[model samples]
Target: MSFVTLSNSRVETTPPVENNSDSGVLSPEPDASMQEYYQLQMDLLILTVILTGVIFVTVCFFYPLKIALNYLLGAVGSVVYLRMLAKDVEKLGRQQQRLSKARLAIFIGLIVVATQWNSLSILPIFLGFLTYKAALILYVLKSVLMPES
Candidate 1:
């Protein structure tokens, strides 16, 4: 509590305001709210891997081996991109104020190689790179449809 004196000899007491700004020193361990965020990140990563496997198997069954291999490469790159994004988000405010462009470099490199390589098909690889977005859409739909779960 803090006390303040008025000009007319009046006195008042007030509670101290809590500081919630990120400029302050952060705790060594994340709090409960941050735990939920970390859990969501893990869940997204898991869901992406599951979708990648299902799609890869389906592609292998329907398409040629070369196209399936190209898609697998792109899907792996997508997973790497997702993890890098999560790491960058986790470091936000503590280490950096903005997201890094380094993550996009992986996708650009993949596209460049796909365009240059004769065996790789651009369409399959591009679709594979969107695997993470598909997983995220599924996650959001689940959350919206089944909030209690």
Candidate 2:
């Protein structure tokens, strides 16, 4: 463990990772906590896909097929965004890197394309992109409302 002092403040950062004597590089094996983190990431993705399917089917029943298809496109984008976010998070401490804005760029690009394309409806697509957020909220609520035995 290491700490740096700036002025009067003490800042804590990722501890020095053990280096492999032969390779002279950081160990590639992840710790146990990373396994739990990976499971959480996988769970969120699964929940988002399930939610997207249900919402897409509901939209198809009430709206035109075109709108439903637009929403599906955005849902796919949202999945990509979530995957990128998870990768960034997984790299956080281990790699000692800052979070990237590529995920936000993806969302912005999706919106821009949706707006420019005459066939795509912006509202449904935007709503579809928020599917991941809904899944996050659900996960939080579930964790708070239900605890492991």
Candidate 3:
């Protein structure tokens, strides 16, 4: 492979020429930025899971088992919700997606509110939701500070 300079600040890789005797098919190269983005997403997911576990264990020490379980469930629910949203956004670009952030937040909030009215505590659920938001904030910050090359 060789590097091609498009501008003073940017350089791109040019695929090496393959022998004609070999298979004519060209293999695709993996994108570095895409790999980095996926790695960051996985890291955020693992961090969220660890935070949820820590919160659950800490709450368990002070609260009853049932309440502790409720907190864990809420955290898991938030994680699932965020994952689903990410999948949806991936499948359909943000401009094409019908759901807005406000709508998504309201929908999730309603679900949590329903749970609170029925049985579980609102504070724990809200805290769990905030954890996901924190992860999102971190992701945005990272992206802003270190843009893809």
Give me the runs in candidate 1 sitting further than 4 Å from their true place: 1-28
- What digit string (tens of lDDT, one per residue) describes model 2 on residues 97-122? 68988789888998999889898889
The per-prediction CA RMSD against the true structure, in angstroms, equals 14.8, 12.2, 12.0
Off by over 4 Å in 3: 1-30, 89-117, 136-149
Cα lDDT of candidate 2 equals 0.83
lDDT leaderboard ranking? 1, 2, 3
Top candidate, metric lDDT: 1
Model 1: lowest-lDDT 10 consecutive positions: 12-21
Candidate 2 vs 3: which has more TM-score: 2
Question: lDDT of all the models against the reference?
Answer: 0.85, 0.83, 0.64
Indicate the residue-level lDDT of 58 in model 1: 95
Q: What TM-score against the true fold does each predicted structure earn?
A: 0.81, 0.79, 0.57
- Shift of residue 99 alpha carbon in model 3, Å: 6.0
User: Hey, what RMSD does candidate 2 come out at?
Assistant: 12.2
